[model samples]
Target: MRRLLGRRDFRTIFIALTVSMLAESVLVLALGVWVKDLTGSDGLAGATFLALSAPMLVAPLAGWVVDRIPRRAIFVALNVVTAGLLLPLLTVRHAADLWIVYTVAVGYGLSYIVLGATVSALVPELVPADLLPDANSALQTVKQALRLLGPLIGAGLFSLLGGAKLALACAVCFLVAGVMGTLLRSGRQAVRMPTTSDRPTWSSEVSAGLRHLVREPALRTVAVCSALSMIGLGVGESLYFAYVDQGLGRDAAFLGILVSAQGVGGVAGGVASALVVRRLGEVGAVAVGIGLFALGSLALVQPALWLALPASVLIGMGLPVSMVGTNTLLQRRTPAHLLGRAATALDALVSGPQALAIGLGAVLVGVVDYRLLFGAIGVAMAFVGGTLWFARRVAQPAVSTEPAPAQADFPG
Candidate 1:
């Protein structure tokens, strides 16, 4: 970990990403809260997240753009542009100006996809393969840690000052992140240019990432298991509210305590993720993460506060461990030119279904018993974890035929 952080480029990227994500964490909750305050409508407030996530439907396009640009340049540009985009929110004083908030939310979503793809592609250039897990872990840890404080800070600021002031603060964070991005001394490789005869069709170009994900055995396992796990996650998203209100006999405020507990666990998980990957291998680490998440789900079935708190912690711990393994594996296996596409492809596969499941769970929670739902989610996640563990035994190692980039050191 120390050695990985010693690299100047990686350190710079780390700080930049941390600052950027802090802004993201702060703004996301504030956006929803601001909308709720403006309209006094829960449905409209909920729509804020929909606006933020809707751009994911265009992730393929975003990924294609990421691949076409110099990643470092795009990373810096996106931060500056995102800061400018947030300035519109300052004008959102009335319900009539709600469009500004939603528009900016869409911009936020697009920036997230582009920046995420850029970073996934850029990180390999900044770190050695042997240190990839550590680098990813460090980044994930800081991001997770911010979840514990960023929202609280944003909420407090919004309450003390105003939504416009909060927006300005978040914009400043992005600008600072852009400054950090300028300090990156590496990841400046030339973009890949296809020859006329070898040029891909638009459809093929867009689907390239998905095709590669299906073709690669390790990535395939990770994608499949991760998608399966998302089913549980999506269902849990809606059902958790019910679990707290009815199952635990608690008010909505208590939900914050559970989330805080999860954040603490997430911090610990991020800190330990590199070691988990080192000992278990990427596939094994993901399996364990999913399994732990399943255990957390099962604990929720008991409805006791004691079980719920610990369960939230376990659930929190599982996500970072699995994500670190997934990111490290993707970086190690993907070709430089395809990294952006591959990363977005995986994001779409996992997040799309999770979004749908949130809707489905919202419907099901109304008609079905919460305990039955929790149990089913846990069992399904456990099955997915077990499937990955078994599949790892026979999975073939990744062997890319594409020539390596001259500047980047991608591991086989």
Candidate 2:
């Protein structure tokens, strides 16, 4: 971990991402709470996630753009633009202005896809292959750790001040992060121009990431399993608001506390991720995370605060552990030129289901018992995790080979 920090470029990127993520974490909870307060509808509040994730359906375009531009430039531009984009939230004065909130959510989603693809592509250029796990772990750890304070600070500011003030604070964080982007000295790549013969058709360019994932055994396995787990996760996204209000008998702000608990668990998971990856391999680590998340989900069925807090912790822990494993595997396996598209393709695969599920959960939370949803989520995740674990063991040899297309770039 110290080794990654010791590098000037990694340090700059790390700090930039940290500042940016702090802004996101602050907004994540506050946005839902703000919408809920305005409309008094759990469905609308949950739909904010739908708004945010809806842009992921266009991830291929975002990926193409990321790959075309210099990643560092894209990184800087995205933060600056996102800061400006968020300013419209200042205009959302009443329920009639909910459009402003949803619009901003869509903008946030677009920026998230572009910026995430840019960062995923840039990281491998900045670090050694062997340190990918540690680097990813460090990044994940800090992002999760900030949830502990970011949500609290967001909640406090929202309750004491207002959502507009909270929005302004987040904009400042993004601006500061953009400034930090200028400090990065590595992971800058020249614009990629395809040779005439190799010029990609629109469909080919857009689908490149998905094609790569399909061709790689391990990547495909992990991605499919991860997407399956998101089914429950998406359901939980909406259900949690109801859980806080009806089940736990708390107000909207209390949702921040549950998120903060998850952050605590995320911190521990991030710290331990590299160790888990080393012991279990990336696939095995992902399986472990899914199983842990399943346990956490099942625990939520009882609806007690005592159970909820620990369940949030387990959910938090599982996220980083699984994410670190997934990301490291992607970075290690993919070629540099394709990283942008591949990352976004993976995002589309996972987030698409999650976004859909959020909508379903929003509706389901009203008619169905939240406990039933939680139990179903837990069981589904447990089954996916077990399937992934079994597949990893049986398909060990096949997983070792790189995709056929990747070989040209990585010729021995």
Task: Report lDDT (CA) for all predictions.
Answer: 0.88, 0.85
Q: Give the TM-score of candidate 1.
A: 0.95
**Candidate 1: deviation at residue 261, Å?**
1.2
TM-scores of all candidate predictions against the true structure: 0.95, 0.84
Q: Count backbone overlaps in model 2.
A: 0
Compared with the true structure, what per-residue lDDT tens digits does model 1 show for residues 240-340? Answer: 88999999898999999999999999999999999998888888889989998999999999999879999999999999999998998888888888899
Worst ten-residue run, lDDT, model 1?
403-412
State the TM-score for model 2. Answer: 0.84
Q: Tell me the lDDT of model 2 at 120.
A: 85
Error of 1 at 169 (Å): 1.5
Model 2: lDDT equals: 0.85
| Cα distance off (Å), candidate 1, residue 54 | 0.7
